[model samples]
Target: MAAKTDDSGPVLPPAIEYAWGLRDRPPKGPRPGMSVPAIVDAAVGVADADGLAAVSMSRVAKELGAATMALYRYVGSKDELLALMVDAGYGPSPGPPPPGTDWRAGLTRWAWAEHDVLRQRFWLLHVPITGPPITPQQLGWMEDGLRCLDGTALTEGEKMSTLLLLTGYVRNEATLASQIAEGSRATGAKPSEMMPAYGRLLAQLIDPARFPALQRVLAAGVLSQDDDPDDEFTFGLDRILDGVDALIGRRAAT
Candidate 1:
């Protein structure tokens, strides 16, 4: 048999090719001794322990016991490393919602799953969104969200808009929660203490005569920490879903 030969052209960027397992390997010699997985894991650890601000090439290199320059052979830059960390942290998507489940239930589960990821890796919220996500794991989450509305009587554009709305709501909620938690940590104040203090400050700042609705809300004790965070998330989600249901019903009636 003749020596085997394969001929295929390069198909992806060097970094992405390496990510997809298509990059060239060093000739049979001393191994490079570093792997992409190790680098990403170190970066994730840094972010988890000290927040995204602590993640840097030198820090990750130090974590891996490798020279800072050596990391560049595997990851092109800190941006590449951040991208890898994002994809690695995403891991895998949740299983599809039970068959025939209503869109609301399916979507609520989807949103909660996303919330769990954001909460666990709270640093991700600080990762400036460079652009629409292109990584496999991120796209998989998008697909999962779309799948939730698979049976709905919606056009493709409508499906996208609905998903975007839900995603925005979830992201905003998570961001707010993270801010509140950070504030609590910084000020050493419990939510119970903070809410009332904030309410008092607002009450002091706003004239009751000029803001009747705000005064009513303040008097109703809505600023108290009586409601669990889960209850608040469910309430907002239910209201959004109800609005969608009304729109769908009106469309069907027409």
Candidate 2:
């Protein structure tokens, strides 16, 4: 589908146009086994099996048994393909919270849905964020997130900012979790073992006098072992929502 663009319309990349169904597919007889969605699916598969690093255009093309140049015919470039791959990888949003749900509960659900998606496809955390969400699926997620704040006293900008803040928190938490898990795999250390090992190492290196606060934490065995990932996730999510709750309360009062 060709994009609805006029003489003064904003220029979008070819892959993005295809994603929006705004760009036509190959005109040369449908290209028999090649399409934007096919190409993106292939790339996502490559990332899933290997990793984001394994998802080169040539690799995706090889998987499809098509020439590397053939991929370019559908997706303008590797960056374009990566963008499309991320859009497809997200699949779709969990959708807005059920009707009549409180805003906090809706946002809580939205945040968890995103957390679940990233955890399942941790490779997505590795993709560089060159810009904000604009692709179809990405925008859909954004819409759902924003919808959670609808009918609140907050203004549009505040709503957008709240989503941004919440999404950022979710991504940061997911990224850290992914890194720790990767570290465990690389070192052959189980999740439960790594934190305790680190605590021991810190206990040896840190002087109680020089690092009293850290020493107190160490003494309390706070890092005795890894915390349940879900527990950690819930704690952070609740705190962020608490701040949002306060903001909403203030807005409503005024």
Error at 188, model 2, angstroms:
1.0
Off by over 4 Å in 1: 1-12, 18-32, 203-206, 250-254
Model 1 scores what on Cα lDDT? 0.78
TM-score of 1: 0.85
lDDT of model 2, residue 126: 89
CA lDDT scores, all candidates in order: 0.78, 0.86
TM-score per candidate, in order?
Answer: 0.85, 0.93
Q: For candidate 1, what's the RMSD?
A: 6.1
**What number of clashing residue pairs does each candidate have, in the order they appear?**
0, 4
Q: Indicate the residue-level lDDT of 158 in model 1.
A: 81
Top candidate on lDDT is 2
Please give, for residues 1-254, the per-residue lDDT of candidate 2 as tens digits.
Answer: 12345699967777786667885653132358788788888999999999899999889988888888888777777878878888888988999889899999999999999999999899999888877667998999999999999899999999999999999999999999899889989999898898889999999999999999999999898988788889999999999999999999999999
TM-score of 2: 0.93
lDDT of 2: 0.86
Q: What digit string (tens of lDDT, one per residue) describes model 1 on residues 148-223? A: 8776777788878888999899888889889998999999998658877888888889888999999999989887
